[model samples]
Target: MAEYMRLRQICLVAPQLAPVIADISAIMGLDVCYRDGNVAKYGLENALLPVDTILLEVVAPFQPGPGTAAGRFIEKTGGRGGYMAIFACEDPDARGAKANAMGVRTANVITHAPYHGVQLHPRDCRAAFIEFNHTDGSDDILGPYPPAGPDWQKSIRKDTTLSLTEVEMQSPEPEGLAAHWGRIIGIPADGPVVKLPNNTFRFVKGDSEIMSGLTFKVVDKAKVLEAAKARGCAVKGDEFLLSGVTFKLTA
Candidate 1:
């Protein structure tokens, strides 16, 4: 298999799936692709929406406590940090081994037939959980993403939100954090940004290290902002706060 990697999905955590999922769908004009029942085993419920080809997911723990990792993540960051950045790659095991060699422990390894994923410890990863996954015999960018459900692509709506353009990671030492993430993702940092095949990860200075914001290309910036305001989101300038991260709208 040829070596390649791209940001496949971005996960966000919320106290409840409600208004977060509803607000994002309403404001961005996105459709809910799937609500994975597989997560119930972990005492959680999730909903995934297609932001173009990339999946945008929000997970909330129904049983909120130390028993679940999602619950612990919410408490640790006070629900401020984004949960995970999942990448579709050629080899997940090789990537996990590389991260392990660098002292980053593997938090979990999930395998369900064709799909295989390796999640690195969020504490060691700093900003958020880093996951590398691959689906057997599916190398095409839009092909069989098990996590996003069987017909996720059918729900793709580009009328309002076109695509997820960038992910903004914030840390006190942005440059260092960028370099660290670059090493893990095997993409060398260009100053404070790691440019990927489909999207860009930009690190900026902040009080703590976390995935702070997401930038999106939309059809009409004003319309999106209006929808956000209607949904009771904290809208300011060309951005809004929903599910603990800023949604920056762009042309």
Candidate 2:
């Protein structure tokens, strides 16, 4: 099995980027790290924010048109939710081969100089899309993650939000879905959680298979929740629903 070095990034989608981006910036007290120019080629727009070493991204379609994957994703998942989970690994080719052998569809391959990324089709895994990337010869966990754009780490701001502590994947059959994802990612599904070096991928019960929520280690959970409420998000217990996903804060 190819070793996954760390949790590099999490991609979420919104119906529209404006409101969601504003809400995330205000509630999390984080700024946009980079608006990747490459996304426009995919008929989408994106904004990434670095919280500690992890990249939190929100993607939206550039225009409402048929056949665009982002548009279809919104309709499939019923508008705005977690879309993709990316990890940095020591060897992407070996890991990708493992998934390919397991009957996972290879969606796309991206390469730019020293960085190489492989994207797997979401349907094959029965959850969200999974991506494995590697920067040639880079071993430092805190080092460059190319998908978030160069200099993403330089944009790290830690006032309210810190690290992405957990990713919550919801499905009616969580155990089965977890096993599928575990096999695809080369991580063992131990109960409902797949443990990574920097974060945990948690599978929980829901109506369907989707990435439903994210848990962040925050500097001030109450204050963050309060900010979320002030920004017109409906507060529920320790979480606030935004962009069709629940953002849970923990101190």
Candidate 3:
């Protein structure tokens, strides 16, 4: 079985970039590393931020045409959920082949010298788009993540958000959803949780299949909430709904 090294990043899609990108940067105290021009092929614009070694990305469609997958996601969830859960692996092709053999749809394969990736179809995975990638000679978690653009690691700011600990996937049937994802990702479901090496995928009961929320290990939860509340996000307890997804801060 192929093993995922770590939870590489969480990708979120928003209807618009402005307030969504602004709120995430201000509230979470994360630095915007790069505005990737690479996604132009998909008719989308994106911003990448380093949340420690793990990344937080938000993509919005520049063109609302057939090429915009992010636009499709926003329309599907009514702009109310997470989009993709990406993982870093030693060899993504092995995992991609495994998923392929299981009848899962392999969506895309991107390679640029040292970096290579395979994206799995969301319809087959059932909850979120699953992507796996590897940097040719680098196994370090803090090494180059080519998808985030160069100079991405230089943007790491740990004074506020420390780590992305959990990614929440929601569905009407949590157990079954987790099981389906488990078969695809090669991770066993712990009841409703898909336990990974560094973090966990939490399958929660909800109306539809979507990546719903993220749990962040933070330095100041109060400060984050205050910033989020000021930005007009729907705050409930320590969590807030922003960019069509939930942000849960924990110390």
Which digits, one per residue and each the tens of the lDDT, describe model 2 over residues 108-209?
A: 999985899999898997778898888875577667666677777777888788878998999998988888888888878998888887899899998888
Full-model lDDT, candidate 2: 0.85
Reference-based TM-score of each model? 0.98, 0.95, 0.95
Candidate 2: where is the Cα deviation over 4 Å?
A: none
Candidate with best TM-score: 1
The window of 10 residues in a row where model 3 has the poorest summed lDDT is: 1-10
Q: State how far residue 12 of model 2 sits from its true place (Å).
A: 0.6
- Cα misplacement distance, residue 165 of candidate 2 (Å): 0.3
Per-residue CA lDDT of candidate 1, range 1-251, in tens?
88998999999999899878888988999999999999999899999999999999999999777668889888888889689999999999999999999999999999997999999999899989999999986688788988999888899998999999999999999999999999999999999999999999999999999999999999999999999998888888999988889999899
Q: Which has the higher lDDT value, candidate number 1 or candidate number 3? A: 1
Candidates 2 and 3, the one with greater lDDT? 3
Instruction: Tell me the whole-model lDDT of each prediction, alpha carbons only.
Output: 0.93, 0.85, 0.85
Report the Cα lDDT for residue 223, model 1: 97
Quick one: ranking by lDDT, best first? 1, 3, 2
